[model samples]
Target: MSERTDPRVVVLTVLLQLAQEARQADTLDAFAFVAANSLKRLVPFRNAALWTDRPARSGVSAVSGVAEIDPDSPAMIWLDALCRHLAEDTSTTGPMGVRPENIPPELEPQWTEWGGPFALWLPLRHPSRQVVLGGVWIIRDTAFNGAELALLERLGEALGETLSRHLRIGTTRSAILAALTRRRLAIAAAIFLLALFPVRLSVTAPAEIAARDPMVLAAPRDGVVARFFVQPNQMVKAGDKLFELDDVDVRNRHELAIRDLAIARTDHKRANQAAFADPQSSAELSILANRIERAQAEEIYSRELLARSEVVAEKNGLVIFTDPADWLGKPVKTGERIALLSDPEKVEVLAWLASTDAIVLRSGAAVRMFLNTAPLSPLKASLESASYEAQMSPAGVLSYRLKASLAEDEPPPRIGLHGSARVYADNVPLIAWILRKPLATLRQLVGL
Candidate 1:
């Protein structure tokens, strides 16, 4: 009633018996160690490599009948391609065997150089043959015969079920809990220490680097900008000609005023001579003197207008704005903003703290700034002032203005550079730190 067994058949039967001991897989190492070592005894191969399909833990490999296997070696590449093809293309009719010349052109050169064995790619599929859990690759000097391939394929179904147990995420939860039980005291102590820890609470907001003392440069008169002596961000000293206006109209008025003043003086002198000749002409003499005085005032006013056309810088600083094209040939009314001159040495940070996050902020709080351009190195600072009321930000949100002074030892940031700011508040319990904002809002909302 029973079939007789050959030595090879007896070895395979023993190998299958040893592998079936895996009741429910818990780890890849235990399952792989049993299967790979047992397969090496039954199969006539120089090496065997087994791997999983998951990306997170795929790098580790278990080998049998060989001292080592390099991941970068040609054998590994061929194994990778075989597994991928087996998993992706189910159209392959049945278990396939590869001879030496059957390898792809790209992989042939590397395979020949290694002088390795003829590799076999075996797919371990589910019992129903619906899914593949993983794969096995064995190597030998010659191509495996049909009877040997059939035996390997028959063993794949049982191996797939056992391997799938280890691939599951929840299968090891009971094992993890049991291990944690042995160290329960240590874990409990760590949780207790973390709860009692007091830490400073901090809030981050949008911020910008601004000049401490910014001077407003404006149009001196209602005229077009003729020329700019310096470009934007150029350093200028007091009395430096910043720009010139169209002075043709003012120059013409000055010339007319000068000619009128000379004529008025001559008339006044002739009237004085006539007044001495006749007493009745004294009234005419008074009128001519008044005309001469009026002409003198007109001439002075015209001269002032000509001087005002050429605007000059009043302080030493850098002019901040766009290029020359924005100013040149642009008509501006008197007192219209031209640009801002900022002192490079005197600079401060202006942070827009959102109203929701500004409740915890106080004067003299520790502040840290990271300019967008230099994000790695944060600039140390201290809060100087905060607005009593909220104002609309450029981004259309109501926020409070906060001023901060940079550290004395640190170099000043460039004016108008925008970045982020973090303000550290008072220390509190870990629980309070998490619930601080929500509690404040609750009190304000319902007076709780």
Candidate 2:
């Protein structure tokens, strides 16, 4: 039995050729190429083309037997339109045969113009579903017999499976498209929310509560803290003794000035009485008067120093020191700090925004704080001020100081309480909010 005469031999040969090409194909384009050049031998055609309608792509992939239909030719456009019309209905679950006679009357003129004067289309669909994958257009004069159609019908299933197997996109695009389209209302709602809704563009930072009126008492003059009148955090009233300076030295000086003034005044009075009796005594009286004036000035200064010996609270508040022992016997310079007189009720949040994340924070921006002690019960506040310069935070991270005022009605956070805060800033789109950071990072790295 000759190969040409034997239908079984021809079919087997064509199958082997197609299998080899199928194995070599890596993409949808390559698969389409293999189908175009190889399938014609079994179902002979004068002109043939393969097309697909996958995501992000649509049009002809491969052509065979016709060199006349070039890219710039009008025939390509007509062919595309013709195939698109046929592929509109994806219910063609499997490969289906069609002849020139089956071509709809509305499409006949176009079919004659581009695809072919006489042709057949084998519409291929997803192997497992009703969705149309693509089709093969073959131009031939002879009609397909039962044996030829049978051969193609038996093999079309495998061909569709091969197309599916080789396709990189697969059903993922369709699935996503279906999800987006089926829940169109949800998509519209999301778009609407993104466009109209004003979300907070917040910057998170480490924070703590600080007293608004923190009165720090500094040493009036050089002295050692001789004694502490109260313990740490002890509540005190105005004029209450807070601590005492080592005033023994100051007292001695005060006594010396007082004794010196008394002696100078006594001497000056004697000189004045003598001035009336002797001319030399008048010169002595002038010298004594000068000495008496110097003594009085000295006396006044010494008394002022002695008065400052006892440190007192000028305003009402708790002593804001951790340990009284820290101040005991410690020698301090003039104007050296001692302790803070802080009203626990008068407090504000001091947040440190990282240098990298800091933005132009306006006054009265929204602020939400969460203390380490009470993470769940968030306290609300508003931005009061932001530092013009960056500084190192307590943790050593470079940050900008941001001030905020907690709502008065909300329980005032304890003075010196540590926490974290989110400072709300300028508005941005929802997509921008999600992607801006990543895009910014990418631009920095890639310099795009």
TM-score of each: 0.52, 0.58
Kindly list the per-residue Cα lDDT of model 2 for residues 205-277, writing each as its tens digit: 9999887868998888988999988887788999999988999999999999999999999998888888888
lDDT of each: 0.76, 0.78
User: For model 1, what is the alpha-carbon lDDT of residue 116?
Assistant: 60
Off by over 4 Å in 2: 1-198, 276-278, 435-448
What ranges in model 1 sit over 4 Å off? 1-197, 237-239, 277-280, 314-316, 436-448
- How many angstroms is residue 230 displaced in model 1 relative to the true structure, after the best TM-score fit? 0.9
lDDT of 1 by residue, 1-448 (tens): 9977798768678557756754344677767766666676556787676766763645325677544568776566666665565556454424556545765566556665543667776676544454555677666788788877767776665676677667662335445655777579778887777766798989899999988869888888888888888888889999898888889988999999999999999988877888877787778888888998999999999999898998787888988877889878888999998888889988988999888887567788899999999999999999999989999988888999899999998899888899999999888778777787889899889977
Index of the highest-lDDT prediction: 2
Task: Give residue 112's lDDT in candidate 1 (0 to 100).
Answer: 56
Candidate 2: the clashing residue pairs are none
